[model samples]
Target: MDRATWDRVQVLLGQFVYRSHQMRYAGELIHCGHCGSPITGETKTKKNKKTGGDKQYVYYRCARYNDEDHPRIRMTEAEIDEQILALFDRMRVEDEEFRNTFREQLRRATNWDLGTETKNED
Candidate 1:
């Protein structure tokens, strides 16, 4: 096959594989805090009354949400994204002391590598 055709085939195959396993955060990425079960992802379609168009929304929820004692809470993908962003914001290292320590470690590693190389040359 030609180069362009081969590239197109590869793209189509990749899309097919992705669709076959469409769950984005259902496996080991997320787990239920309440039940300790893996979170599952699902797509819900809602029909817009005015435009008669279907809007699809992705949601993540505990796999045991339907169980008797599990909390019946489902979080939209957007909500999960916001929570993740907030977590990252909270985890950001802004301390000057930490920065200095990291710089020192990097400098030491570089110096050690240089020393090893010089010794090997002897």
Candidate 2:
């Protein structure tokens, strides 16, 4: 395959594997609060000779870590999951206007247009 085709194939394969891993670890769904980029997870396994098994370590890292100015930011999967859960617990959903705004933002992010009527009504 040409370099472009090979690159595209590699990207597609990586996406498939990442999505599969994400489904298995749902609570790890997170984006970078700093740059709005999706976060990716990495796993490392080491052999444990005594137990005849592998020790696994998982990390959730920001995707925009290419810049040296931005220090590498990462968290253990468990830590990030727990922190997210805690955030949800403390979050308040009582603001109607905020909820509506957030819903509209989500719709826009998905490229769904809000009709003029809806805007006028708002």
Candidate 3:
């Protein structure tokens, strides 16, 4: 909620920007759920209402849904992550290089910008 907190979030999220294997998705956040066209990017915010008040999560929803012209289904963050992870789990084991890259990328993301922020007692 303060400047220091925002700065930390920015830095942590920044680390995730330039990576290869971590990006298992074939399309950017801009891509539409139907036509596969580029749309607006995901928006980030602090989810203070959650149980842990986790600040790390960044969420995106298609803006086209709000448009009267384009009516489409909205998806959840958990759903999206599940789909990507499922795809990765099913990735061809014959490709040793790809599997290795996936492993390495997962390791990097797990360790990246990790730090403890205090839990809100109120």
Arranged by lDDT with the best first, the candidates are 1, 2, 3
**How much is 16 displaced in model 1, in angstroms?**
19
Off by over 4 Å in 2: 1-28, 93-122
Q: Which residue pairs show collisions in model 1?
A: none
What's model 1's overall lDDT?
0.54
lDDT of each: 0.54, 0.47, 0.45
Query: After best superposition, candidate 3 residue 120: deviation in angstroms?
Result: 18
**Lowest summed-lDDT stretch of 10 residues in model 2?**
113-122
Error of 3 at 111 (Å): 9.8
lDDT by residue (tens digit), candidate 3, 27-118: 34346766655544343335668675544432344545576667555433334444544555665778898788764564344344223222
Candidate 2 vs 3: which has more lDDT: 2
In model 3, which range of ten residues has the least summed lDDT?
113-122
Per-residue CA lDDT of model 2 for 10-120, tens digit only, reads 433342222213322323345677887777776666665789886555556677767676657766533543453344345577997876664444334222211211111
Candidate 2 — which pairs collide? none
Using lDDT as the measure, which candidate wins? 1
